[model samples]
Target: MGQKVNPIGFRLGVNRDWRSRWYASPQEMPGFLHSDIEIRDYVKKKLLFAAVSKIVIERAWNSIRVTIFTARPGIVIGRKGAEIEKMTEEISKMAQGKQIKIDIQEIKTPELDAQLVAENVALQIERRIAYRRAMKK
Candidate 1:
């Protein structure tokens, strides 16, 4: 029988890496995992317009570094960097007071990003554009 496999998981170690990098004790693993999940979701929902493509979480000692890959860095950074500052504070709370450092990376060629291309198509469709026209772009 045919089976479906996660493309990312299939490529892990071959050419891909884990989105999260951390070492946690058995008793604390679950909490850390859940916190990672919540932080990811919170960032995505907060900056939905930012076109986030990937989020990499790296933890060491008592600090967490959140690297966000997005097509729109300005939206994530906001005016005067206020948005990112607020975001960092919120994520710190999510990490239970651990330091949160947010690093936003802009996608140089968003046209090649599958997520960005798909989101563009969806937005065109939402605007009542024909499917064929949407795909053409």
Candidate 2:
């Protein structure tokens, strides 16, 4: 009875952008898509405590740029950025020798982000908090 659209998808290219900003050739599309998935999965698994909101990947001639948006930048950055360094090393291996650049962006308003809000709600529910009370704040 209602047409439901994802807020993020609806805003793409206007107020938001794609996670992977690359134009792949017809023959190369599958590989590129797979690589994107691998990179995203690696970040999610490695930085589970980071409260990551999004991972943006951009392709250059000889390098790939990965920008991670998270609610907890400190945790992702770690002490002196050692965690990021380690993640870079791991991602480099995944990249198959391509140069990789990693950037961490902090989310100032997690409450306004759909993904973050859902994650927060799920976390609260797991901790036995009431859904209404958790979402109220």
* Best by the lDDT measure: 1
Off by over 4 Å in 1: 2-4
How does model 1 score by TM-score?
Answer: 0.92
lDDT by residue for model 1 (7-103), tens: 9999998988899999999999999899999999999899888899999999999999999999999999999999999999999888889988999
Error of model 2, residue 70, in angstroms:
1.2
- lDDT, candidate 2, at 64: 93
Clashing residue pairs found in predicted model 2: none
lDDT of 2 at 32: 84
Per-model TM-score on C-alpha atoms: 0.92, 0.88
lDDT of 2 by residue, 94-134 (tens): 88989999998999988889888888889999999998999
User: What root-mean-square deviation over C-alphas does model 1 reach?
Assistant: 1.4
